[model samples]
Target: MRTNKNPSEPRFLFLITKPSLQSTLLLQALKKRFYNEVTLKHCDVIDSSTIEDGDLLLFDMMSLEEQTSRQWCQDLQNCQKKFKTLLFNIPPHYHHRDIVEWPMISGIFHTETGEENLIEGIRTVCRGEKFFPKSINDYLTQQLNLSHPQWNETVDLTHREKQILSKLRQGASNIEIAHLLFISENTVKTHIYNLFKKLSVKNRTQAVFWANKYLR
Candidate 1:
C-alpha cells in the first residue's frame, strides 16, 4: 500500500539460480512496484563481497538444488558484513525445512504466494522482522519446544546476552548486532558462543526459540 520509495531503503537483489520467465516477471514486478534499486545477478557468479549491509538477497529456490542453496546461505552467514537473505519461488509442497534452519534466512516466498503477499513479505523483512509463514513458525516452535524445561531453570543469561538474544529473535546478523550494541564483532561472537552453550542451543534459530519460550 505504501507506494513511495526512499533512496535509503534496503536494496533488493535477486539471485537467479536459473533463468526463467517467472524470474523475469518477479523482477519486473518488484522494480515497478516496490523498490527503486531492485536488480538481478546469477547466484553462481555473484561475488559475496559485493553484497553490502542493508541489501536483501532474494534467492530463487525454484531451480536451485537444496544442498547448493544451503551452501550459499551458509556462505552468507559466514560473511563479515551483515545482509538479509530471503528465499523465493519455493514450491508449495517443499518438504525440506533444513534450508530455513539458517539464521541468515529472514523470509521465504512460496511460489503459491500472491504478488501482494510477496511484496508485503519483502517489506516486513526490510523492516527487520522475519517473514516466515505460520507453518514454518510452527515447525520451528515444535522443534525448539522438544527441549526439557529444567534446562531453562539452570540457564542464567547476562544482560548483554539477553540483548543479543532479543536481536536474534528479530533476525539480526552477528555483524548487525555488534554494530547495534556498540561491541566488536568478535565480542558478539564470544557472547553468542557462551550464551549458546548456556542455553543448550546450537544456532540462532534455536536460540531465538529458546528466548521465545524462556526469556520474559
Candidate 2:
C-alpha cells in the first residue's frame, strides 16, 4: 500500500474509459479545483505496466457488463502494482452491491452525486477510505440486520449535528446546509467533522447512510 503523507505532491488520477466529451469535462473540472494536488490522465486499456502504486483509477461503470466488470476487478487485484479503484456513473438501482466487498474498490460514485461530493469522494478514497452511495449502504445494512439482529446502539449527537445531518440526508451541500442552519460554512465544517467522528463514517455519503439507518 502506498502512503501519501505529503499533501503537496500531485496524486495521479487515471481515468479508465474511452475518450468522450463528458470525460473531458470531468477531467477539466477536477483540474480546475485540484490542479495542484492531482494530475489527470486517461487510458482506454487496463495494463499493469501503465499503472503505478498509489495511483487512483476511476473506472467508468457504464462501460462494462457485470461479468466483465468482475473480471476487470480481478485483473486489477492481480496486477503487480497496488492502486485504488473508484467506480463512477453507477445507477441508483445497480445490482452489484457485492462489488463493495472487493478490496481494490475504494468507492462507488452514483450518477446523482454532485460535483462537490465527487471531489470529496476522490479525496476520501485517496486517504485510504472507502466510499459508498447511500442506497448501497442502506441495502447492506438491511442485509446485515436480517442475518444478525442485535440491539441498536444509540449515538448521542448535538442538536445542531442532528439538524445538519437532516439536511445532509436531503442532499444539501455545505453552503446550502450552512444557509439553512443560519451558520457559517466553517461552523458547518466543524459540526460535520464532529458528526463523522460520532457516526464512525468518513464522508457525507456514509454519514447520510448512518442517519437514514438509525435517525430515520
Candidate 3:
C-alpha cells in the first residue's frame, strides 16, 4: 500500500546505470505522456540528496553486471531515502533472487516487457502499488517449487476455492476469474478473501504460490 504524503501528485526519479541517447529519447516520451500527473527525472547514478522520502525510484538494470547489481541492491537497502523502488530490464535468468526479498522493491520489469506495459507499471508503482509482471511471478513460482514443503493434502479447500486457485495459477485477475466462473465480481472477491484465510496466504501471489506448491 502507498503512503504518499501528497497522493494527488507524486514524483518519480529514474536511476539508469548508464545514460544514452536512446534513454534520453525514452525519458522525453515518458514526460510527454505523463506530463500532467507525474514529475520525472533521470540520473546515471543514485543521488540520495535529490531523493525525497515518498518518491518512486526507477532503477534500470540493463547495464548492471551481477556483482554490481548485488552491490547496488545492498546500497539501496542501506540508504535512508525511504523511496519506493522499481527494477527494470531484469534478465530472465537473474541469479540474485534475494533482490526480490528486498522490502523496498515495489515492482520489477523484465527485458521482454512491452513499452506500454512498462509505462503502466511505472504508473502503477507511482500510485503506491506493486507491479510484478506475469513472467516475474512465474519465475517466483518456479523458485518456490524447487524448495517447496510437503503438501498437507488434508488442508480443506472448497471446490469453488480450488477452481479459483486454478484460474489464479494461470494469472487470471479477479475480473477475469469472475467472468470465467460466471459469478459476480463481488462474489469473486468474497471467495478470494475467504480462500486466502484458508490457505494462510495474504495476496493473490501467495495464493498462487500455495496452489503451485500443493496443487501441482
Give the whole-model CA lDDT for all candidates, comma-separated. Answer: 0.74, 0.68, 0.66
By summed lDDT, the worst window of 10 consecutive residues in model 2 runs over 144-153
Best by TM-score: 1
Residue 24 error, candidate 2, Å: 0.6
**TM-scores, one per candidate:** 0.69, 0.55, 0.54
Per-residue lDDT of candidate 2, residues 13-104 (tens digit):
77666668987787778767655334344443546466666777777777656676666755564454566778888765667545553435
Indicate the TM-score of model 2.
0.55
Per-residue CA lDDT of model 3 for 1-216, tens digit only, reads: 434344533555454546678666666766665553333344434444565566666666777666666666555543545567778878767744655644366788888777788888877877777788665567676655524444233468889989988987765556667888999978988999998777666556567767876775
Candidate ordering by lDDT (highest first) = 1, 2, 3
Worst 10 residues of 3 by lDDT: 36-45
Clash-forming residue pairs, model 2: none
Residue-level lDDT tens digits of model 1 in 1-216: 222256435654555566668778878888876555677777666357777667778887777776676677666765655677788788867764665665477898888788899888888887779998888888767666737553454577789999988988877777778889999989999999998888877667777777877789
- Which parts of model 3 are misplaced by more than 4 Å? 1-9, 36-47, 138-216
The count of backbone overlaps in candidate 1 is: 0
Candidate with top lDDT is 1
Candidate order, TM-score descending = 1, 2, 3
Candidate 1 lDDT trough over 10 residues, lowest sum: 1-10
